[model samples]
Target chain A: DTAVSQTPKYLVTQMGNDKSIKCEQNLGHDTMYWYKQDSKKFLKIMFSYNNKELIINETVPNRFSPKSPDKAHLNLHINSLELGDSAVYFCASSPTQRGNTGELFFGEGSRLTVL
Target chain B: DQQVKQNSPSLSVQEGRISILNCDYTNSMFDYFLWYKKYPAEGPTFLISISSIKDKNEDGRFTVFLNKSAKHLSLHIVPSQPGDSAVYFCAFGNEKLTFGTGTRLTIIP
Candidate 1:
């Protein structure tokens, strides 16, 4: 069983379209996060949720929103997707919020391409 | 601005040699550092980590060295094997982890 899993391993959609990527963790982690890695392979945290509560919201655009129905799941929904949004989106989970004992476990990643 | 920086894009080392990957961070609030190894099309796997309280942590052939005073960290792999070839990313944990751009290491056989 996968500790962290994501849906839509690959997605291709036209610009202005709306899509969503779902993530779930089986590790019983209390905190989950979303990260975006651009074509240049630069990774940045977009958002974070602790026990279904929004914790950290980076400088991400308003078009992107993260929803956590439960501690085990976090989904990202993008509205009016743009070409700049074409990148690999990764979901991660940790037991605590930046605690010394916590280490983030990442999913396989969702590759999103906006044409 | 990027908080964590891996200046080297790639590195090549002969098998059985030592491979050293370096990373620097501008944020002083980051008290925990970790190294991850990622293969193509797969999620990153934890390699090693070191807290600011400690200067070094070792696991098998992998060792992470932290220099808090210099705001720098390095991962050293001794007797590098071909299986060690992968992209290595450095991460600093505060409220969230900030990762470097990643450095691809190739171990030549």
Candidate 2:
């Protein structure tokens, strides 16, 4: 079984269009994260949720919002998407402890392209 | 600013040679370090990790060495095979994980 999965593996939309990517993990993990990989292959963390509580919110733009309905799901919604927003978005999950040393299990990323 | 930095963008190694990938971090607060391998059209998978208290950790052909004083870490793959060719990312785990720009390793047969 796929440990982690995301919907719409490929997304192509015009500039200013809004889109949403859904993610789910079956790893029974307590923490989930959203990371963006740019054209340069630089991966940066965007948001994180631990047991449905927002934990880490990076310096991402306001147009990006993350919602975790439950511990197994974390979805990202982008508004007013721009050309610079074109990149690969990855969803990952990890077991959370008081001092977490766990590794992340990532889903097949969702590629977003803005024209 | 990028806290974790992998200076080499790409590396090529022979099938039976040792591959050394280096990483540097500026955050002294980072206590745990990890290496993740990514293939095309796929998300990264965790490879190996090292703690600030330990200088080296090894698993099979993969070994990770951490130098807290220098704030540097390296992943050494012995007898690198073609299947090992992938993008390797160095990451630091604190409240969250921060990744470095990946290094693409190409194993030549």
Highest-scoring model, DockQ: 2
Report the lDDT tens digits of candidate 2 across residue range B1-109. Answer: 8788999999999999999999999989877899999999999999999988999999999999999989999999998999999999999977688899989999999
Candidate 2 overall lDDT versus native: 0.93
Summed backbone clashes in each candidate are: 0, 0
Residue A114 C-alpha lDDT in model 2: 98
The TM-score, computed over Cα atoms with residue i paired to residue i, of candidate 1 is: 0.97
lDDT of each: 0.93, 0.93
Q: Distance from true position, residue B70, model 2, in Å? A: 1.6
- TM-scores (chain A) of the candidates: 0.97, 0.97
Q: How many backbone clashes does candidate 1 have?
A: 0
Worst 10 residues of 2 chain A by lDDT: A95-104
Model 1: CAPRI class: medium
